[model samples]
Target chain A: MLQTKKWRQYATFYAFVSPWLIIFIFLGLFPLLYGLYLSFTNFTGFNMNQLKFVGFSNYKTVFLDSESMYALGRTLLVTAINVPISLAIGLFLAVLLNLKIKGLSWWRTAFYIPSVVPVVSTVLMWKFIFSGDGLLNTLFDKLQLQPINWLGYEYATTALIVMLLWGAGGSLLINLAGLKGIPADLYEAAEIDGASPVRKFFTVTLPLMTHILFFNLIMGIIGSLQIYIQPILLSGKTLLDSPIKPNYLYLVHAFQQIFAFQRFGYGLALMWVLFIAILLLTVLVFYSSRFWVYYETDQEV
Target chain B: MMVNAGINKPLLRVVVYGLLTVLTIIFVYPLFITMANSLNPLYSLSTLLPTAFEWENYKMAVTTIEFPEYLKNSLIICAISVPLTTLSSALAGFAFARLRAPGKKLLFVIITSTMMLPGIVTQIPTYILFHKMNFIDTFYPWLLWGIGGAPFFIFMYRQFFSTVPKELEEAARIDGCSTFRMYATIFMPLATPATWTTVIMLFQGTWGDFITPFMFLRDEHYPLATALATIGYHLPDNPNVILAQPSSAAAILFMIPTIAAFFFGQRYLVDGIAAGAVKG
Candidate 1:
């Protein structure tokens, strides 16, 4: 009787969770493993049945390919620059917003509004901001300064970076939550010990916020590397004038390889390379976190 | 934790307010610019403000972009996907949180690991599979995310459901209720906050997604994001002009729903994300 009851209970459990389990295996796992296999073969567009398995050749081509290498370099450069800039801005805003200022939620809402704005609209706003005759140049004209071409090939990347920083409010919210999580008694104790505001912030605030910062950093790096929409919107093929070349990032390159050139095998191979790199880099970040990431529980023990 | 600002208190307040005001302006300046540019009759940069405000630009944008169709498509996608995703996630979350299941921990770890697999790794095969299944150009690929959405929401729901007191379930069980009955009647109603959080997030995500629709759907089936992006990128026959008024209007129109959603749902949105940060 107990055995029958146990089987019934197990059936109920499976019934509750089966939706996610069944769908994930069929939709997610199947595609991922199939894609991995495709990376090893020359699977051209619309020719799924004729895939010729060429072991290691696709990986070899990806490594030696100049365009692929350049795309990777550009992606890394973006990750390096954008992630730190976003963190600094986010942390700075979080600190200010935590000051118990009046209309705190209103101020936060204003800052965070941009981050949640649809990407299409956000990119459209940036297009005007960086346009030759747009707001920045209008300001330049008012100040009697020469108008610089912000979207020129030389300055396009910088313009894109500035646009990205406008969305740092997302991370600011995370950091602010982290700040709020710190116990009030720590600050009280610090004040009792005669620590200055600056000292209190450095010793108590910064150390406690490291884990949040670490989380944001990992997310930032991962997000920046896969950036597609903004760059594609800015420089992608459209009916309007063409943007100057050399603005294509990794995803765009892979996209063009698959859709534009019908090199499905090469595109999948590029994706695998990106995947392996992300895994390694993520592992490295976790490994390196031992030195800087703080744990209150660890200290207590 | 309070410190005496002394005579400098007012000055410090002024400084704080001044800094925040400036930052707010900086944050929202582009939006003002977009609105201004969209209203300008001549579509000229000669004046920062519109010399003549024109409603014609908005009309032209709507007509040119088939804005109604885009809006309808987006609403349809969000309506179906949100409920399906929330239901699936909530059910699964409840199971993992309360039910006696074998290999539950292992199963959860596997699902969570899916979060790390970048979409690009699966993009090609999924596309081909969908194509083979004749799902391209249909909303099926996106709508099907109801079943196989990202594990982010599932993980979040699990975190949330785990916090609910187990006595509620025990009481429901002692009353001879079925497992589904207890989940639906007792637990789910209590998880209203998590439900709202999941719905809002899923809605926002479905609402904003461009590339998926851009890839899978035809022009007629385009959602708000893809429609707006394409129209903004390719506003016919006006390349050199900085702010093509019609396209700019379209952009503003695209922003309206999302901005409204954020303002109304800010509390839940913030709480949800913060919870994720804490738990993840």
Candidate 2:
């Protein structure tokens, strides 16, 4: 009797969540599996009849392709540099904002306003700033420094990174919340022990804020890895820019090959590789976090 | 001792004030430049301050972009989608948090797992599906996806509902309240902060969304972001075209609604985000 009741209870629970499950199965899972299958076949534009199951060949092409290899390397390099620098600046700003100062709320709002601006506008604003005779160059000239080509091949990536960091206030705001959650008593005790503010921060603040740091670190990595809009918009691509900067072109090329060229199989393969890379990186971070991540609850590892 | 303490306090206050002012400028100057340039009269772009205010640029960009039509489309889409997204997520969240049903944990896990998938991966297939249904050009797909509710919203509401006390619901149940009333009267009112957070987030997200409308909507139905993107990208050739003149003006107009919303609801947004960061 108890078993039957329990089963009915489960059924009732599943019924409530049925809507999401149904959508996920059809929209999310089906497409994923279909994409994976399409990656192995030579499926082109709107026709699956021509899809030949030439297994491993598409994977081989992507792996050995010089252009794709360069894109992969570039993506990794950009992510590595962008993540740390943005986090450092964001943490610094969070610390600044957390201090008890007058008009603090206004300051917080000012810093966060840019983040809520539509991406199209933000990109356009950056475009204006980076133009040959734009604000950046004008400023450099006034400072008596030689003006660098802000959007040239050598500096375009750097410019994008800088644009990205301007909106770092969103993450910084979250960091402030984490900072506030740290018990005030801990800081008071540290001060009583004659610890310097810097020492207290390193010991009390940083240690307690690890969970939030972990959250930000994961979110930042995931968000940056799928970077598409800013580069595409700023670089003047209408659809997918063809012959993407040899370094930045691979993901776009893969996307185009799937959608434009009808090489669904190849696109799927590329996607799978990306998925695995992200999953592995996340898992690695979580596994290594055993040493540093401080959970409030005594949950099992 | 008293003299030294007073001296140190003032010095610290001055340093804090100085640092904050510099930081504010760093954050606000780009926006100021964008706004100022939009109102500049000269067709030739200047890097420094504008000599005169040109109000015509704003009017011209609005007319050329067919701003009224774009604004209507944005409002209609957001109005329909935000409520549907919030209500459905709240329902699902309530069920997950309060129901005594089985498989809740598994269902929750399944919903969250989808967050790992990048949106672009799902774009092509969804397009194909919508095309088959003959809903490509229409707003049906956008509405349907929004109504389906997002995992992030669901997760947020679940955490929020969990924080609500069980005693209220128990007392209501003893008073012979129906299950629906129990949720509507007790649970929903208590979860106002979370609901508002979800609504604001969905509103902001839907308003700024470009990729979906760009992929699905026809040219006649372009949303604000898509319309602006079209102008920004296509205006290089004819600078004198009414739409092309003072391109920065159009960008400024695109951002106005969002900036306004952020300032007005900033306190709630901050509180919600803070709670979310801790619980999430």
Candidate 3:
């Protein structure tokens, strides 16, 4: 009777969990492996049965292809710049909002409202701002300053970065949540020790919040690398003719290759390269966390 | 919050208010411009207000982008996907947290690790898989995976379910409640916050989603986000365009539901995010 009860429990467990299991296996794991397989074979997405196993040729092409190489470099540069600046701005806003102020929720809502607005909308608004005859240039004209072409090759990446900064409030909200998690006692202790507000922030708050910072850092790197829609929406004519714009990042390149050029095998291979880069970067971050990230549990220990 | 006690109180108040006001303007200005321009096709950068209130932009957006069809597809996807995803995610969470299923840890690790994987790595193969199964072009690719595919949601749910005291489940089990019964009758009600969190999160994600629909769906089946993006892409090529009136209007229409969702669900959204941040 006991053995049968255990068996029944096991069966129920499987029944309860099999939905996620089935989906993960079929939709997640199977496809990932198939993608790896397709990366090896020269499949142009025309016919599955016509796949030709080209061994390491696709990987070679992804590395050697000029557009792919430039895209990788450009994406890395954007990620390197965008992640830190955005996170800094987010942290700054979060610190400000953590104060004892009225309408705090309203302020947060106002800030985060842009984040929830559709990306297409945000991109559209920015497109108007950056257009030659748009808001910024119009302002410059009134100031009697030379009108710089914001969407030109010189400023395209900068335009993308500026546009991305508008949604920094999303990360600010996350950082606010992180700030809230820090125990009040830490700040009190620092205060009793006669620490200044700046000192207390550095010693008590920043240290305690490093884990959250780490989380955001990892997420930021991953997210910034996969930027697709903004570039696609903003590029307009630049990307259609030449896929090598400063704003034409990695995922956009992969997308144009796969969907636009019908280079399925090549696109998948490029993504695999992207995957490896992200994994390495994430691992580096994780490995480096031992020095900076702190836990209250560590203090207790 | 209490750290500024030593400073000049009145000065501090002024600084805080000043900072908030400036930030609020910075945040809301572009949106205000967009909303104003959406209503005024004769938009110019010189004035923040429109010369005339014109309904033509809205009409133009509707006709040019097939706004109604896109909205219908988005609603259909959200309506079907959100509830199914939430329910399955909760079930998975309950099983992982409350039950003694073997290999649960390993399975969960596999799921969570997918978060680190570049999404595009899986995109092509998943597309091909759906293609092979003839699930492409239909809503099946979205509905199926949406219901059971969110490892992050499952993780969130598991974290929540773990917090429910074991005594409640033990008591429920003593009354001969089946696992499903205990989950349904006892634990699910307690998981309301988690459910709401998942609902809002998944709703926003599905609604704002562009890549999936852009890649998979035909023009007839495109969501509002994709349709608007596609139109926005081609707008500059139109020589007849003077002020991006139709695009601005399309943007406003696309943003309405999300803004409404934010206003209605801000509390749950913030609470959910706080819970994730605290626990994770």
On lDDT, the candidate that comes out on top is 3
> Can you rank all candidates by lDDT, best first?
3, 1, 2
State the DockQ, from 0 to 1, for candidate 2: 0.46
The predicted structure with the larger lDDT, 2 or 3, is 3
The TM-score values for the models, in the order shown, are: 0.94, 0.93, 0.95
- Which portions of model 2 miss their true places by more than 4 Å? A1-12, A242-250, A299-301, B1-8, B231-245
**What's the true lDDT of residue B19 in model 1?**
89
Candidate 2 lDDT tens digits, A1-301: 9997567656755665666667777777877777777767776645755567888888998899776787788777778888888787778777777776667788888878888888888988887888777788888899999988877888888888889888878786688888888888787777778777678768887888888888888888887787767777676645454432723734665666665677767777877787777888888888988889888774765
Candidate 3: misplaced stretches above 4 Å?
A1-5, A237-244, A299-301, B6-8, B43-46, B49-51, B233-243
- Give each prediction's DockQ, rounded to 2 decimals: 0.58, 0.46, 0.60
Reference contacts recovered by each candidate, as fractions? 0.59, 0.47, 0.60
Query: Docking quality tier of candidate 3?
Result: medium
lDDT of each: 0.79, 0.75, 0.80
Better of 1 and 3 by lDDT: 3
The TM-score each candidate achieves on chain A is 0.93, 0.92, 0.93
Model 1 scores a TM of 0.94
